[model samples]
Target: MFTIATWNINSIRLRAGLVTRLLTEEAPDILCLQECKSPVDRMPLQLFADMGYRWAVARGQRGYNGVAILSRLPIEDAGDRDHAALGHARHVAARLPGGVVVHNLYVPAGGDTPDRTVNEKFGQKLDFLTDMRDAFRAEPPRRSILVGDLNIAPREDDVWSHRQLLKVVSHTPVEVAHLSDAMQAGDWVDITRQDIPTGPLFSWWSYRNRDWTLSDRGRRLDHIWASRDIAAAGHASRILRPVRGWDQPSDHVPVLASFDLPV
Candidate 1:
């Protein structure tokens, strides 16, 4: 069995030690990271390699959006696409043994406004999801897993207060619909939701909250998805919420899925 995890580290360089701690503790076979906020060459990759995550593929920029995959297993960079023509370093893919592909992505935050007419970032977010849907429609995925801080919390149960957040950028109906279309296009199964079908689930808590755990006002922004054939092999899905309490932690936590498949 192999386990894979995803986290929006916010800025890898600023919190490299936290990542090392996670590696030492949970030890997922593959870890997908978003918002690395550093150039690929500047990433502290040697430290990861020393911890046994010897293989990796990353797309990074100076100090903004970035996505990377660190692996203990043998893998090759399968390449990436610039969805929505945003020109951000937000997507990366890696091919593992037996033809399995993993995609790490960081979707736009869409700003504070939910209305696309007044908010260009919101429009870009929708366009990104649309482009993803079209791409999957063109060539559907197989034996694939996609993970990242997708930004939107699609379900009512995904947020602490869905009714209040209906007009919020990430929880708005339009964003949810866009996300659903992307999932349907690729026939992706939400591994976490598939395992825990009910209750309020969250992976991100706002840093603005002085006592985030006490307030518990969080959203399930990070996600793990699997193609039809591979979805059945996935189990033991969980969100490491306690990680959010770590010193100088990212607002987001890690989500993991254990697969009963060969490496």
Candidate 2:
């Protein structure tokens, strides 16, 4: 069995120690991290490699919109795409030894306003999803896994209060529709949802909440998706919610999926 995990670290440099703690504990075969907020060269590669994650493919900017896939298993850099013509380092892909491709992405967190007309960031987010849909429609993925902080909470149960967040940037109807279209385009299966389809699941909590667990205001922003061909192999999906309570924690937590496939 192979275990893979996805997390939006928010800032890799600042939380490299936390990542080390996770690697020491969970020890997933592969870990996809988003919002690295550092150049690829500036990442703590030595630290992770020392812990046995010697292979990686990363796309990163100086201080924002970055992603990386770190693996203990052998893998090759499969490159990335500049979705929506946004030159940010928001995507990176890698191929595992047995030909499974893994994509790590950090979707834009639109500004406060839900209206594209009033919020340029919101329009960019929509455009990014549109580009993703078009790309997948043009070349459908097979035997692949996609994970990231997709930003939007597509399901009503994905958030603490869907009604209250309807007009919010991440839970807006337009954003949900766009994200859904992207999913349909690739025929991707939501691994986390498939594992636990009936409950209120979440991977992100607000730092604004003084007592986040007590308030329980969270959203299922991070996601793990697999192509239909290999989706059935996916099992034991879970969100590491307690990680959010870690020291100097990020607003997001790790989401994990285990697959009954060879390395």
Candidate lDDT (C-alpha), each = 0.95, 0.94
Q: Which ten residues in a row have the lowest lDDT in candidate 2?
A: 110-119
lDDT of 1 by residue, 92-143 (tens): 9999897899999999999998888998998999999999999999989999
Return the lDDT, model 1, position 11. Answer: 95
Off by over 4 Å in 2: none
The backbone clash count of each candidate, in order, is 0, 0
CA shift at 8, candidate 2, in angstroms? 0.4
Collision count of model 2 = 0
TM-score of 1: 0.99
